[model samples]
Target: MNSSLSLEDFIASEKASLSEAMQMIDKNTHGIVFISDEKGVLIASLTDGDVRRYLLSGGAMNCRAIEAANNAPKSALSQKEAKKIFHKRDYVVIPIVDKKGRIVDIYTGDPKEQKLFRESLNVPVVINAGGKGSRLYPLTKVLPKPLIPVGDLPILELIMKSYLYNGCADFHIIVNYKKDLIKTYFRENEAHYNIRWYDENEPLGTGGGLSLLKKEIHETFFFANCDVLLDSNYAEILKFHKEHHNVITMVCAYKNFNIPYGVVEIGKDGVIQEMKEKPLISYLTNTGIYVVEPEVLDDIQDNISIGFPDIIEYERSKGRRTAVYPVRGNDWMDMGQFPELEKMRVRLSSE
Candidate 1:
């Protein structure tokens, strides 16, 4: 849960500089505070995670702390009062400010206790775990792709966290090859989630298996692949979907793959029209994450192996708005290959 900490309660001296902020980060006791002047006008705050992101981004000892700070709680709410509101609103700490409106502190509020809005538990996330990880090769030969351990945890766990962090708790996992192993393992090490399993007796494509999910699914929810790692806040995506009233929202990322030599473009006369250096090309790639309404299940053919793209194209032909939310390059990962698996393990472990 995010803290509803306000700027007022959280403000420390930004002038204390990065050195002082690093010390506080090392202690992990008090969140680094920012004081505007050498005096005591709290302007900003910093947390250990903030330091971690900065550090991972090659931050140095002399780097400015103000640049890395989130500065999120921009609302005009008091510390104590904001805390109460956040609790009643089902959010953790919300930033607050002093009466002067300069950033000051954070408020610690718990939604579980206050039962804010009692958010209707309608969102259902579906993860496609039915693929045979042919790309991962020998490692995946013994274990299912979802069960592959990237670091301290399996890939599926990490994928689930991406959705869980977005306030999604209900999950429908489609299992096929080695289904027993998945079921047995989760049963032994139970996660605090409402997981309703959908078993595919025969191998089915992404769209085919999704059709068999329990009839309880109601509102729009997200669907993700087991082999992809997407670092995003689902709440943001959900809000975007609602504001746009989109029936299908696909998460896309800017990606570029390299080619070594210069390329030439020719015209009809076989004359070189353009010769350019190894120019960088950008692509908006499908990150294998999607936001869709439950009505989409109706398009899936029962007991068929239909890939998701077929359904997406079907929706496109129907004139439904299939929107794409483009994310930055570093936010998405494809761990289907050996090199990518190692890279992801390193990145996640470092964090």
Candidate 2:
């Protein structure tokens, strides 16, 4: 057990805003924060999952921190008891409180403990690797985008290994551009990947390729673009998709942009309705990662060019259930462009 973090870092006031608690959780890197009264008596525990669920349920971020917290959190009276509780359950961190219910220290297990506690989701993954990466230019001229190295491993390999870590071994890869090199590289690699390759005779836009897997995929699976990587919990995403009974779950990332200059809202006939100085704008962006149902693929026409977003819209128009699962802005990484490629490289290398 590690108690290196100061108590203040782990404890948030009961009166604190949900945004403040979220910031504290991000700073702690433990994915949780303790809500305590002014006297430091623990009242509840808030986790990243809690915040996500709160937002999904339409709770406002400006609300009190305790509003999104688990009021009945498991706590221990001593370090020994905390350790036992931590080992016996999936608790990421446990708070040790005095007889008066005042928190003294927190028991955060080893750094690697987080990985050990991740629940495995044995699902199939479909990757769209057929794009002719125009943005990548010269690099694409020589190598496929998926074959480009992020660190020591190819980006496609990194994407596969991520799913592999979560117990997903079945990979259905759709390849077209520079297909020979992609196949040869995997053929020679030492790692034995259970991949089912599908070739597109003509260029098929992102969603078009799914038609090839119409008969193959009979259950829920992951559909992703080759140039993006997501750090969110796949198991939790799957759970949300299943619980909501959604035909498609688009994994979106929260992107925040700050306007450097003052912004004005215009009403009728050049009338200014509202004005703010240097406002911050936040929105959820599609990360090109999705938890998809097999039935959706049946609607995709074969040998046709269509984007995934269009497919989503077509499904939505038909009154099908489609939802969005949001993740932090930094959790989604795109290597489709030059600058982002370098950023992804640095990010993966550091990891």
Counting clashing residue pairs in each candidate, in order, gives: 35, 0
Off by over 4 Å in 2: 1-9, 13-16, 37-41, 97-104, 111-120, 257-280
TM-score of each: 0.66, 0.86
- In candidate 2, what are the lDDT values of residues 32-111, reduced to their tens digit? 89999998898999987887888889987668889999999999998889888987886889999999999998888656
Error of 1 at 118 (Å): 16
How would you encode candidate 1's per-residue C-alpha lDDT over 1-351 as one tens digit per residue?
Answer: 234333333444665445455454333223344445354544555654465456447664355778777664334457567766765664434556667655455555543565323323347789999989999888877999999998988898888766666567788899998888887777777576668888999988877888886375778888888999876556666766788878788888655444578989999989999987865454567888999888887777789898888888998898877777755456777898999999899988866
RMSD of each: 10.3, 3.2
Candidate 1 — worst ten consecutive residues by lDDT sum? 1-10
Q: Which number leads on TM-score?
A: 2
lDDT of 2 at 286: 92
